[model samples]
Target chain A: MITPELLLQELQTAFSKHKYGAEPGELYAPIGYIMSLGGKRFRPLLTLLSASIYTDEWQSALRPAMAVEVFHNFTLMHDDIMDNAPLRRGEPTVHEKWNANTAILSGDVMLIRAYDLLLGIRPELMGKVLARFNQTAAEVCEGQQLDMNFEKRWDVTEAEYLNMIRLKTSVLLGFALELGGLLTGADEASLQLLYAAGENMGMGFQLKDDLLDVFGDPAKFGKQVGGDIISNKKTFLLIEALSRAEGTYRTDLEYWINAADFDKNEKVQAVTKIYEALDIRTFTEQKIREYFEKGLNALEGLPAPDGRKIPLWQFVHQLVERDK
Target chain B: MITPELLLQELQTAFSKHKYGAEPGELYAPIGYIMSLGGKRFRPLLTLLSASIYTDEWQSALRPAMAVEVFHNFTLMHDDIMDNAPLRRGEPTVHEKWNANTAILSGDVMLIRAYDLLLGIRPELMGKVLARFNQTAAEVCEGQQLDMNFEKRWDVTEAEYLNMIRLKTSVLLGFALELGGLLTGADEASLQLLYAAGENMGMGFQLKDDLLDVFGDPAKFGKQVGGDIISNKKTFLLIEALSRAEGTYRTDLEYWINAADFDKNEKVQAVTKIYEALDIRTFTEQKIREYFEKGLNALEGLPAPDGRKIPLWQFVHQLVERDK
Candidate 1:
C-alpha cells in the first residue's frame, strides 16, 4: 500500500505540474492564483486514498482528484464574493486580488474545466460520473443559498445547520470518494460504503473546524480563535448554546450577539465564559467523536482488507484530531 | 423536409415544456425567469435545423438543443452581473430582478444543469460532445473578456473587434449546429461544414446587428438607431471609420469620442456623419454579405438534397437580413 505521505506527495507534485489555463489574463490569472494558494488538498487526497483502497494504481486518480480540488476552490472564489470575505488561506481572496467580476468569470471557467477533467474517464463511466457530479454541484449551491438565508434569521435549528453544511460541504466529499471508487471499478456496494465514510468524516471535519475556531490555540489554528463567535456565525456550537442557554445565560449570550459596539476581546471572553458554563466545548467534542467513530465504522465495514484501509483511517484521524 | 418555422415551433414547445428546477425560490426563480424571458430561441432553433439537414428525426435533438439554449442563458445571467445590464429581452435581467448573488449562484446551477441535459446523449458520443462543449464554453468566456478589454481601449482594430465577436458570439452557434450533426451521426466532414455554416452566419448576424445599430430605420429597428455611436461602442463602423477618416473628419471623430458630456442625439448625429463620410455603411454591408454568402456556400456543399438544404439557407438569410 502507498503510504499517506507518498500519496500526498504524488498529489502535490502532479498538481504543481498541472496548469489551469492562461490568456485573457484577467479571467485566467485569478484561477491560477487561487489554485496555487494551496489549501489542505484534503479533498483530492481523500479521492486518491479512496481509490487506493480498491487498487494499487492510486496515481491514475490524480487528474480526477485535481478536479475535486479545483471545484472546491471555485466555490471558495464565488463564496468569498458572496460572504464579502477578504482573505483565504492567509492570502487575499480572488475577488480581493483581482475584482468581483474577474473572480466570477474565472470561477465559472474553473467549473467548466472541472467537467473537462472528468471527460478523461472511460466512456462507459463518464455519463454516470457526470450525473452524480451535477447532483452534487447543485446541492452545494443550495447549501450556500440556505447558509445565506440563515444570516437574516436568528432562530435557525441545529438540524437545518447540519443539513446546510451537508449540502454545502459534505456531499462533495461524498462524491469525491464515490468518484474514486467508480474509477477503480469498485462494486456498487463498495462505492456506497466509500461515500458513507467520506460523508460522515466530512461532517466530523466541519464540526471540528467549528470547535477549533472557538477553542483552538490561536497560533496553532492559523487564524483568530472565536471569529465565528465574534461574527455571530450560526455554527453548531452557537445553535446549541442558543437553544440550551436559559435565564442569565441566555441573556448574556443574546447580549453579546446583539452588541453592535464593544471591545472584541471582551465579547469573546464573555461568550467563552457562557460556553464553558453550558459545557458546550465538551458537548461539541463528544459530537465530533461520534461522527468520527461513525465514519470509522463505515470504513471498517468496507470489503477491503485492513492493511489497505489503514491509510484512509490515519488520514481521517489526522483531519479530525487536529490540535483539540 | 421540415420548414424553418415548423422546426422553430417544435423547439419552442419542447423548451417551454422543459423546466429548469424548483425550490429555494431565491436560487431557482431567477433561472426560471431568465429562461422564460424568451429571446428568439435562435441557438436551439439552429440546432434543430442542423439536425434535420442530415436526418428526419430532428425531434431527437430537442433535449441537447435545449442544453445549448440553457448554456447560452447561463452566460447571459452572469454576464448581466458583470455588465450590470438592467434588461434582457425587454425584461429585467436576472441580476436586476433578483440580486447579483442570486444571479451568480443560479447561473452556476444552470451550467451544471446544462451538462445534465447532455447526459442524455449516447454513451459513445458523450465524451466527444462534452469535450467540444468545454472548448466552446471556454472560448465564449474568452470572448467576453476581450469585449470588456475593448471598453478601455481606444485603439482597437477592426480585426480584433471581429475576432472578439467570433469568440463571444459565433462559436456557440457553431457548436449548436455541430452538436446537432454529432447527435444525428453525421460524418466528421459534414459536421465541420455544419459548424462553418453556423459560425459564418453568426459573424454576419453580429455585423448586421452592428450595421442596424447605426443605419437601420429607427421605427423598425426596435432600439435606438445610433445607440452604439452614442455610447462610442467599438463596432465595425466605428473601427473602420477611425482607420479611414482624415483631417477634419478625424479631428471631429476624436472630439466626439473624447467628449465627457454631450447630447446623446447630437453625438449620434455627429458620429453618423463621420461614418457616412468614410462610407462605412457600404463597407460594413459588404462584409456582412461576404460572410452570409460564405455560410450559404458551406450549407450548399453539404451532401444532403437541395430540398433539405433550403430551410437552413433561408434561416441564415433571415438572421442576417433583419431590417428591424
Candidate 2:
C-alpha cells in the first residue's frame, strides 16, 4: 500500500506535467506561480487514495483530482483579494505579487480551467460530477460569505460558526472523496458513506484548527499561538466562552473584544483564563473527538472495505491529532 | 416582430419568475434588484432577437436568454467589487449597498444560477452551449486581465486597447448572437456569420462608448461625460493623441497625464482640443463606421438572405446611432 506521502508525490507529479495555455503569459503565468507554491497537496491526494481503495488504477482519477486542486487554488486567489491578504503559504499572494485585478481575472480563468479538467471525466458520469461540483462550489462561496458576515456580528453562535466552517471547508472534502468513489463505480450507498466520512473528518479538522490557533506551539504552527484570540476572531473557544460566561467573565471577554489597545500577553492570558474557567477547551476537545469517531465509523461502514482503508482512516486520524 | 423593448420585457418577465432556493429573499433578491436597475439589456435582447430571425417561437429561447442576462449581472457584481465603483445605472452598486463579501458570494451564486438556467437548454445541445459559454467566460476574464495590465504600462498601444475591448466585451456579444443561432438549429455557417456580425458590431459599440465618454452631451450620456478624460484613462483618443502629438502638444499631453490635480474642466477642454487637433474624433468615427460596415457585411453574408435580415441590420444601425 502506498503511503499518503507517496500518493501526494504522485499527484504532484501529475499536476506539474499538466500544461495550461502557452501564450497569454499574463493569465497562465500566475496560475503556474500559485500552483508552484506547494502546500500538502492533500485534497488531490485524498481523491486518488479514495479511488485507490476501490480500484488498482487510481491514475484514472488524476484529471478529477486536478479539478479539485484547480478549484481550490481559484478560491484562494479570489479569497486573498477579498481578505486583502498579503501572503499565502509564506509567499506573496497572487494579488500582492501581481495585482488585485489580475488576481481576480486569473482566478476567474482558473475556474474555467477547473471545468475544463472536469470535462475529461467519463461522459456517462459527467452530469453527476458536474452537479456535485456545482453544489460544492456554491457552498464554498456561501461559507466564505458567512465567515465575512460573522466579522460584523457580535452574536455569532457556536453552531452557526460550525455550520459556516462545515460549508466552507468540509463540503470540498466530501466532494473529493465522493468523486473518487463515483470514478471507481462505487455504489451510491458506499459513496454516501465516503461523503459523510469526509464531512465528519473535515469538521474535526477545522475544530483542530481552532484549537491550534489558541494553544499551538508558535514554532511548530509557523504562526502566532492564540492569533485568533488576538484578532478577536470568533472561533469555537470564543463562541463557547461568549455563550457560557457569567457577568464578570462576560464583561472581561467583552472588554478584550472591544478594547482598542492592550498588552498582547495580557489579552491572551485573560482570554485563556476565561476559556479555561468556562471549560471551553475541554468541550471543544470532546466535540472534536466525537466528530473523528463519527468519521471513522462512517469509513468502517463502507461496503466491502478494502485492506488499504485502514491506512486512509489512519491518515485522517493523524490529521485530527496534529499539534499544528 | 417583437421590438427590442418587448424582448427586454420578456427577458425581465422570465427572470422574475425564477424562485431561487429557501433563502430566496436575500440570495435571489439581488438578481431582481439589479435586473430592475435596467441598462440597455442589449445582449440578451440580441440573443432573443437573433433566435427570432429563424423561428417565431422565440419565447422558447427565454431561459437561455435569461442565462445571458444573469451571466452579465454576475460579471457586473464582481466587477463592481473589484473596481470599487459606487454606482451602477445611477443606483448604489451591490458592493456599496451591501458589502464586498456579500457581493462576491452573491455574484458566485449568480454564476451558478446562470448555469442552472443554461441546464434548461436541450440535452443534445447542452454540451455545445456550455462549451461556448465556458470559452466566452474565460476570454472575458483574459480581456479583463489585459485591461488591468494596461493601467500600469505607459506604452499601451491603441491596437492593444482595441484587442482588449474585443475580448472583454465583444466576444460575449458574439457568443450571445451565436447562441441564438445555435438554439434555433441554424447551420454552422450562419452561426459563424452571426458571431462575426455581433463581434464587429460590438467593437463598434465599445468604440462609440469611448467616443461618448468624452464627446457626448453630459445629460444625454447618463454619467458624467469626460469622466474618463479626468482620469486620463488611455482611451482611443488619448492613445492617438499620445502617438501623434508633436513638440508642444506632446509636452502638454504628457504634463496633463502626469498632473496630480488640475481644474477638471480645463483639463478636459485641453485634452479635447488636442484630440480635435489630431482629428481623433473623426478618426474614431471612421473606425467605428468601418466595424459597423463589416458587421453589416457579415450579417449580409449569412446563409439565408431573407428580408428579415434588413430589420436586424436596422436594429444594429439604430443602436450605433443612438446619442445615449
Candidate 3:
C-alpha cells in the first residue's frame, strides 16, 4: 500500500493533469484558477487511504477521489460569495478574482464536473455512490444555511453547532471514506465503520480549527490568529464563551462584539483574556480529545484486519496533529 | 404506450406527489415555490413522448423526466439571479421572493435533487445517464456564461447568438429526449436521432421565442410583447438585423440600441420598423422553419417504426404551435 504522502502526491498529479480550462473562458478560467491554487488535497487522500485498506488497486480510486476534492472546492467558491470573503487560502477568491456571477456559474460547472468524475466509478457501485453523494451534497448546503442562520441569532446551542459542523464539514469527510470503501468492495458493515470513523475525526478536526483560530501561533496557523474573536465568529469557543460567561465576562465580551470601531489586536486580546478566564480553551481541547478518541474507537471497530487498518490509523493521527 | 397527453398528466401527478419542502425552510421553500409555479412542463412532456417511441414502459421514465424539469428550473433560479430578473412564469422569482443567497443555495440543492431523481435509472444504465446529465448540465452553465459575456459586448455575431441559445436553452431539451430514450432502453442509433431532433427543435423553439418577443399578439403571447426590444436583449432577430442593416437603417437600429433613455413604445415601434425594413422577421422565420425541418428530419430518421414515432412528431408540432 502506498504511504499517505505518496498517495497525496498521486492525487496532486491527477489534479494537475485534469484541465479545467475549456471554451467559454469566462467560466472555465476561474475554475482552473481555483483548482490551481491548491489546498492540502486532504479529503482525496483519505479516500485513497481508505481504498488501500481493502485493495492493492487503490489507484483505481483516484478519479472518484478527485471528485470529493472538486466538490469541496465547488462549495468553497459559492460559499465565499455568500460570505463576502475576499480571500481564500491567501489568494483572491473566485468571486473576488472575477465576479460573483462567474463564481456562481463556474461553481455550478465544477459541481457538474465532480459528477462527471464520479462516472468513473464501477457501474455496479455507481448508484449507491451517487445517492450517498447527493445526500451529502444537500446536507452540506443545509449546514451552510444553518451556519448563516446562526450568524443572526445569539443563542446558538452547542448541539446545534456540532450538528452544523458535522453537516458542513464532517459529512463530506465521512462520504470520502465511505466512497472509497464502496469502490474497494468493502462490506456494508465496514463501510459504516469507515463513515463513523471519518465523521468523528472530522468533528475533532473542526474543533481543532476552532482552537487554532484563537490560540495557535500566528505564523504556524497561517492566518490571522483570533480572526474568530476579531469578527466575533460564532465558533465553538465563542459559543461556549457566550453560554458560560458570567455577568462581567458576558458584558465585556458583548461590548467587544458590538464595538463598531476598536483596535483589532486589543479586541482580540480582550476576547482571549475572557476565554482564558472562562477556561474555554481547556474545555474545547477536552472536547476535541473526546471526539478523536471516538474516531479511534470507530477505527478499531472496523471489520478490516488490524494490519490493514494500521496505516490509516497512523495517517489520521498525523493529520490531526498538524500544528496549523 | 402512453399518449403524450396521458403521459403529461402522469408527469404532473408525479410532480405534485414529489415533495421539495424539507427542513431548513429558508433553503427549501423557494425550491417548493419555484417548482409549484407551473410552467408549460414542455421538456418533461417531450421526455415522456420520446420514451413512448421506444417502449411500453413509458411510465417508468416519469421520475427521470421530472429530473429534467427540476434541473431546468434550477438553471432558471440561478440565471434569474445573474440576469437580476424579478419574474418567472408570471410569478416572482425565487431571488425576489426570498433573497439571492437563498435562491442560490436552494438552486444548488435543486441540482443535487435532480441527480437523486436520475438515480432512479437502472444500475446498468446509471453511469451513462449521469454522464450525459452532467455534460448537459455543464453545457447549460457554459451557455449562461456566454450569454452574460455577450451582455458586455455589442458585437455578438448571429452565429454566436445562435450557439449561445443552443447552449443555454437547447442542449437540455436534447438531453431531455435522450434521457427518455436511455431510460426506455432505446438503441444508440435511435437515441442519437432523438437527441438531434430535440436539439433542432430547441433551436427553433428559441427562435420562435425571439420572434414572439417582438411580434406576437399580446393577448395570445401571455407576456409583455416587445420585452426583448425594451431590454435590447441580443436575440437572433437583433443580431441578424445588426449584421444585415446598412446606411440609415443601420444608424437607426444602432441609435435605438445605444439610446440612454427613450419612450418604450416609440423605441419598440422604431425597432419593429427596422426589423421590417431589414426583413429580419422573414429571415428569422426562415431560420426557425429550417430548424424545425431539421428536427423533423431527425425524427424521421429514427430506427423506430413510423407508427411508433408518429406521436412524438405530432407532439413536437403541437409544442411549436404554442402562441404564448
Error in Å for residue B50 of model 2: 3.2
Candidate 2 lDDT tens digits, A20-108: 65546888888998999987777777788788888888889988888898989888987888788999999999989988766866777
lDDT of 3 by residue, A1-324 (tens): 468888888888889889764999989988888998999899999999999999989988999999999999999999999999999989999999899899999999998998888877888888889989999999999999999999999999999999999999999999998888999999999899889989999999999999999999888898889988888899999999999998999999999999999999999999999999999999999999998898888888888877887668779989778779
Write model 3 residue lDDT over B105-192, tens digit each, in one string.
Answer: 9999999998888876888989889889988999999899999999988799988998999999999999999888999888999889
Q: What TM-score would candidate 1 get against the native?
A: 0.98
Question: For residues B1-324, what per-residue lDDT tens digits would candidate 2 score against the true structure?
Answer: 666667777777766676544442445556667777877778888888788788878877888877787888888887887778899999999888877756766776777767667655665676677788888887887777777778778788888989999988999999998999999899999999999999999999999999999999887988878899899887878888888999989999998889998999899999889899889999999999999898889887887657656546656878878877
Fnat per predicted structure, each in turn: 0.85, 0.29, 0.85
Cα misplacement distance, residue B61 of candidate 1 (Å): 1.6
Q: Which residue ranges in model 2 land beyond 4 Å of their true spot?
A: A1-3, A19-28, A53-57, A217-220, A258-261, A305-314, B1-5, B19-32, B53-60, B217-219, B251-270, B305-314
In angstroms, what RMSD does candidate 2 have relative to the true structure? 3.1
Using TM-score as the measure, name the better of candidate 2 and candidate 3: 3
Please give the ranking of all candidate structures by TM-score, highest first, separated by commas.
3, 1, 2
DockQ top scorer: 3
If you assessed candidate 2 against the hidden native complex, which CAPRI class would it receive? acceptable
Q: Pick the candidate with the highest lDDT.
A: 3
